[model samples]
Target chain A: MHELSIAQSVVEAVEKELESQPGALLRKIGLRIGELSGVDPDSLRFSWECLTRETGFEGVALVIETRAWQRRCPPCDIVFAVSDYQTVCPQCGTRETEHAGGNELDIAYLELETP
Target chain B: MTQIPMERKVLGENDRIAAALREEFHRRGIFCLNLISSPGAGKTLLLEKTLEGFAPDRRVAVLTGDIQTDNDARRLARYGFPVQQITTAGACHLDARMIERHLANWDLSTIGLLLIENVGNLVCPTSYDLGEDAKVVILSVAEGDDKPLKYPGIFHRAELLVLSKIDLLPYVPFDIAAARDNARKVNPAIEIVELSSTTGAGLDAWRAWLDRRAVH
Candidate 1:
């Protein structure tokens, strides 16, 4: 699954940050996954648990913030939040559509502590 | 033990590195394109055709990523162009760090067009930026026209959308109009090109777009 790759990137990123403070232990990591990012949050959480079992982040928790998908209608030129993948215009039935948001996948923050 | 709230991003490190790579590419005047699609969406075939269209005239080089097999690299080698194979082993997508490592051996100065063919995937590749000037996405008619709606992220981020295997459009059940419409639904500004590598239909338009891009 694509979650594994995202998980690895998260781990590597955390590791890089922890390198500067050699005595710090990762406590938690936070991420924001957009609805249209194509990343499964559940799978990423599972993968993170599996990879951090015996590592420096043995007990680190993962918190994910989900963002909703939004779209802009070409014919109406109106922007709206898309709850689903259907492209039908809400105000007008025009099929002309453009996704305005909900495709972001990035780590928002990470928590660490010095032992 | 107090919990310290450090606003450190988990991907912060990689993003910084990716930014550096983008700057380096800009400095060298190299335009890198990251080609992404499903495993059999005709990414390699399209690249082969693109290389044939503009090779020695433009000093083109390719870096192809696959789960396994150097077949893609081998295929491009016959053209006598600079090529590199990045076998991800089992990874589904290519990341910026991987490019940073392999890019060290490449001579970016002599290359006008640097194409980075990402691992065949419609999902994870959308999240990672490989320091490319643009992300070109391919969708084959055989894969169904609804793919753009199903995988909207890739289509939304793509600078250009190529509809491959158009020769099979007549035989297949795919509605070309619907596919184009759906892609526009995701990204209205996306440039769309319909082509068939087998019959060589619609290739001139594709090449013309590349010519315009290379000049710009």
Candidate 2:
């Protein structure tokens, strides 16, 4: 699954971040996955477990925050949450809405133990 | 016990490599396209037809990604254009690092157009950018008109939507207008092209579009 790759990316990012703080053990990883980011969080966590197994980071917590997809109506200038790819403005009934948010895949923060 | 705010992108490594690739492509004046679709969407056939149409006048090369076999690469190699296949083994999509590794030995200056046929999966490929000028999503008539809405992420990221297998429209239940409308709802600026590689229908327009964007 693509989640494996994403998990690997997360591991790499954490490893890079740890380079600055030597001997600090990773305790938790925080991620912000958007609805439209095409990532499955459950799968990511599973992959992360498999990847970190036997490593010092085993049992580390992965906290994922899911963001909802939002779109802005060009005519009505209304920003509304979208469940699907529904671009039709609920207020003005126009189909000229543009994407506003919910495409992010960021590693927000990390919790570490001072060794 | 201390929380540090990194605020870094998870795919930062891939994105950074992709940006470098994009800069290299721009410097070389090579127009690159990433073609994405589901399996059995006739991506190889369309590429074959495209190479046949663009070759002899333009320098074209291809990198096709798949989970197992390099059959698509073999099929495209018949067109006499340079072709390479990246077998993901079991991976569902192609990432920028894969492309960067594959292009390590290749010469980019001789190529005017480079078309990358991503591993056929609608969802996974959407998030991975391959340093292309455009991401073209291919939807066949056989796949139904509701695919854009069903897999909105790919449609939302694509710059062009190619409706392939128009020759089968008579037998299939696909509604082209509805597909276009759905795609537009997700991405209003996405360009649509209808073509059938089997019947040679709309190939000229596709070629024209390629020619206009391709650096030749």
Interface RMSD of each: 3.8, 1.5
Q: Give per-residue CA lDDT, model 1, range A1-115, as digits (tens).
A: 8787678778876676667777777677778778878889899999888887887677789989898888778878888887555556899977677667787676676666677
lDDT of each residue in B68-110, candidate 1, tens digit only: 9999999987777898999999988888888888888977788
Q: For residues B141-174, write the lDDT of model 2, one tens digit per residue.
A: 9997999888888898898899999999999889
Q: TM per model?
A: 0.87, 0.94
Measured with DockQ on alpha carbons, how good is candidate 1? 0.44
Leading candidate by TM-score: 2
Q: Which portions of model 2 show Cα errors greater than 4 Å?
A: A73-78, A89-96
